[model samples]
Target: MNEPGDIEVERELVRAMNDSAGNEPVPAYDPQQLAASGRRHRRQVWALAASVAAVAALGAGLAALLSGGGPSHTVPVTAGPAAPRPVGSPPASAPDAARGWATMRTVLLAAERYENPATRGTVQLGQVAALFTDQAAFTRVWGSGGLGATCGAVADGALTMDHSGVLLYRGSVQLPDHAAFTFDDRTGRISGVSCGSGQLPGGLGHQTIAAVFGSQVSGGKAGDGLVGPQVSSLDCSPADRPLTNWYGDIATGGGLAVPPTWQWQVTLNGDQADGPLSAVVDHTGLMTQATCPTSSP
Candidate 1:
């Protein structure tokens, strides 16, 4: 009872209904597409991890700088060798004798300079003041017309004798013409000075000789002659006794005129004594007898 066209239309309608009622068939799996998706996920994860690591490294570096835990830029230093000591220089701990010798040399050189013609034969009081403890005594001895004038007068002449000697504590430098300079052991001051002819009574005064020798010498009693022991011979005297034999005989109670305190006892050879025995008297006042070393004249 239906037409052919209507039957065809009904068939199309039924096909549509059937398509809507059933679910669509799934597409086939594609290996290439799956691999591409996995690669994209791995790349995203690696990027996130790298970003976290970079942030952590930056934070650590900042913390190290803030806490002062960074490496130092200061350079280290090295030391050099010590300097050497000079020759003939006495050590700090050396005895008074050593110091006295050095000081004596300085004083003598200064005196020489003062006596030079360049200074017009005038004594430099200020320059020589420090060399004496008792300045008054120095003034008395070397003042205007004092012994200093006599010393200046003869300074130009030939140096008949130049001697330096040290005793227990004292020291002396005897120049020509019976002139002598005495220095104290402890103070290093010029204790006394004498420049006179060796004639007696009108010659070297007893007080001057005592000062030159020391307190040990008697100031000269009525018959004691010149006081203390007198030198038996002149400077550079030929030795009458053997070297080994003690020359106690050389010292005598004032019998000879001009008792030579500063004598140079010489052996047959040409060597001279280091210093005169008078230096011993000047330093120690004959408190101790010092044996002179044998040497040529």
Candidate 2:
């Protein structure tokens, strides 16, 4: 009986050793622990590979969206391979007179109103500074007083005048504000423009007014209905002083309410008044020599 049991034990030991050599040792618990470990490692590697592939696909989709599938944003202009078309040029009548004038007017108004009426107080002054030669003239106009006086102008051919008006005041009291537009055949632009009464040195004297305020005005409208009395002839006194500096104790009543409206005498080098005389203007309107008589107060 002892010999039989001992033989059985030897057989059992041989089986265990053979099983370990063929299929690896059984782990702490499961019978198929070794096989399960190999399978789990393979599964983990495959899972990582799949995740990398998914990320690559996502990156490619984003790239396609951003590039629009091409290198440029502008639409490509091309003709079919069978029949190529020719590019045509613009018409000669595309000057767009109305649009051009409207744009110019807008720019002028912006500069006059908000684009730094003077160099000292505003930032936009630099933009409009090129419009005037004398910088000191601009500063003087804004610094002299508050919003006591104002001027405006407008012109249209087939349309009526707009954005052109005035409000005049002298020391707290208001004056008769006058604003008008007329055609100037000579310059092909609107001519007469009246803003308001200003302590501007020359008043509305011929030379001072024409030289100072001419550029802002335009020729006339399409119809001849707006024509006024012919200018006849113009004359200007050499030593004439603007009425603003005069009238200390004139025979008139009230304590100098508004500046006198003098006839604007036109004096130009040669006969440039018939055409365009290069001038200097500020936000306060035309810039004139501010001497004793014409001192632009």
TM-score of candidate 2 versus the correct structure, residues matched by position? 0.18
TM-score of each: 0.26, 0.18
Give stretches of model 2 more than 4 Å off: 1-39, 42-46, 55-59, 62-67, 70-141, 146-297
What lDDT does candidate 1 reach at residue 240? 56
lDDT of each residue in 9-79, candidate 2, tens digit only = 99999999998898975557665987899899999999999999999977886898787773435678886
lDDT of 1 by residue, 1-297 (tens): 999999999999999999987867777999999999999999999999999999998798788889988665567868677566433232324464345443443344334334444533444556666666567855754555332623544232111222222111011122334444465656555555555544222121223333333222112232223324544422233455221100110122232434333322212111233633332222212322233344424
Using TM-score, give the best candidate's number: 1
The 10 consecutive residues of candidate 2 with the worst lDDT sum are 242-251
**Per-model lDDT:** 0.40, 0.32
RMSD of each: 23.0, 21.5
Question: Model 1 segments beyond 4 Å from truth?
Answer: 1-94, 98-105, 120-124, 145-152, 156-176, 196-297
lDDT (0-100) at residue 9 of candidate 2?
A: 97
Clashes of each: 3, 17
Candidate 2 lDDT at 89 equals 15
